[model samples]
Target: MKVIADENLALTDYFFADLAEIDYRAGRGIQAEDLTAANALLVRSVTKVTPALLEGSAVEFVGSATIGTDHIDLAGLATNHVEVTHAPGCNAQAVAEYVVTAILTLQPERVQAGTDFCLGIVGLGNVGSRLAQLAQRLGWRVIGTDPNVQLPEIENLSFAQLLAESDAISIHVPLTHTGQHATYHLFNTQTFEQMKPACLLINSARGEVVSEQALLNDIAKTQRPVVLDVFEHEPIISRNLLDHLALATPHIAGYSLEGKARGTQMVYQAFCQHFKREASKQFESQLADMPVLFNLKQPLSTQLLPLLPQLYNIRADDQALRAGLNKDGMVDAAHFDYLRKTYPLRREWAAYGDQSF
Candidate 1:
């Protein structure tokens, strides 16, 4: 058996040599010619697995180590009899942590006073649900908007109601067709116009789910501020939006160490199931520890941002990408892979303890 693994995937070395002859390369610029003899191809979000890349290849199976599959050509893979799997909900906690931190940073005064504020979770999936729990724990009113979910007790509301009532909105929906009220450009001009002017928008979901130009226009037209962790064109963000937005990060909102390790173990389990092999004992035991929150007598208002990076350094990723602008496409691919494989230690909010400082 032969397998080609994207270099960006976490813990590639641990799983690569176990099953088959492995060919590892950076995800971008990977052509079909490279996998002509491969039975399986593993990748992250950076690689686009289209028909053009698989038509002439001997590849039969595809695996992605991330949640979003917008970059994968699912229809083409199915037509070609190529099986594919993705690690869904693998980074839910990481994204939830980011949302909580952003809420604290954006509205420190409200958080300090424990004043109630509306948090509209646009999608009540894994990440959104986790975030709602955190918001509720912090004494915030949580309103969810997911047309797909049919729960009797959870307060489900219309998208317009969420927009008008929420003081802050966080998106966590997938990008799909419109039949199920798909999330592609879900927050466009009309939706933005309907939002409260004082609203703070956070997009950790797919980029196209929120229109870039429309967000920019809305920010210019109103007091609505945004904190974007995903952009319409990744690795190439809009300059105008960056300058105006309160927070702009590379797509690392869910790239915490715990998240990446969970993704790695999930794929490993999937691979084990495929071969009918007993899952590794170490794999089951290697779960990352949750964050610890330090209880303070007084709310640490001034120490929030400075202390946050200790748990998850948001700015380090920003600076790292900014430093690598001059690299070629292949170099860019290598850099991205390096960042993921050598990802820094990221802990959840609960990981910080009294001794954290």
Candidate 2:
């Protein structure tokens, strides 16, 4: 069987080694012509899977090694009979670490995250739930609002109520445009008005969840701090928003080594099931070589603060992105994709030997 995979995927060679032929190509640079004779395709978020790209192709299956599917054309894929699968919750820990690190980075010395500190988590999905647990462990009172589910721990408050009560808000909702709880542009002028004047906003979720211009206007008026990992138009971010953000990254919040490996494994499993074949290797064996990073003997805070940078540093990513802007003060699409394509080796918190938490 012939399979075309994104070159940037973590373990394409190891996972698809047994296949008769496997072709790897740059995801964004992949064209419809490339898949004309392929039996399957594997990709990351960068590639848009649509009929236009697959209509005349022999491809029958598509697997995305990432959580978000907004980049994929689900309707078109279904109409074309191209089976699709994606890895959800694969990078939950990495993303949770990012949010926590951002909070600490924003106020490294001044922020005492005790019971008095209120953090509002906008979505209670995989990433949000993990973040809530981390925040609670740090002594923050966490309140959440997700109209979709009825979880006991998450206090079902209106989005407006959550904003008013939170000192900082982290958005983790999916991108949707039409519904009672449509999250597209959910954090607009009216929503910002209900927020605390000094609130810090963090968006590691889909970018369109917040209206770009509205967020800009709100930040200009309130002087609120914002940390943005995803943008409305990725690889073509707004310089105005870039300048205003406290932290800016090129959508690498979920690019931890462990996460990427797991994502590959998940999609590999789907590929195997689709073709009715056994997996060539075991995931646990693949991860055996990763080094352990933590010892539980020291004080939690003492160990965590120093260990944070070792796992991943929010500032380093921010600095890297800021350094790539051209003379016209804009990060071209190529440079933006290059940043993610060449991201450093970052491991998740769980990879450091503290799996019990």
Give the winner by TM-score.
2
True lDDT of residue 62, candidate 2: 95
RMSD of each candidate relative to the true structure: 4.2, 1.9
Q: Which ranges in model 1 have alpha carbons more than 4 Å from their true place?
A: 113-115, 150-154, 281-309, 318-345, 350-357
lDDT of 2 by residue, 1-357 (tens): 889998878877788888638998989999999988899999998898888998788999999999878789999889888899999998888888898899888876424557677889999988888888877767678889988754576566777789889988999988888978898989888889999989889999988888888889988998899999988877787677798999999998888887888898999999999999897675556654556777767434556776777767789899888877887878888888888888875876666776544
Identify the candidate with maximal lDDT: 2
Name the TM-score of candidate 1. 0.86
- Candidate 2 deviation (Cα RMSD): 1.9
- Per-residue lDDT tens digits for candidate 1, residues 211-249, read 888888898889577888777876564445566778766
**Which pairs of residues clash in candidate 1, taking residues 3 or more apart in a chain or in different chains?**
291-350, 291-351, 292-350, 292-351, 292-352
Locate the minimum summed-lDDT window of 10 residues in model 2. Answer: 296-305
Q: How well does candidate 2 match the true structure in TM-score terms?
A: 0.94
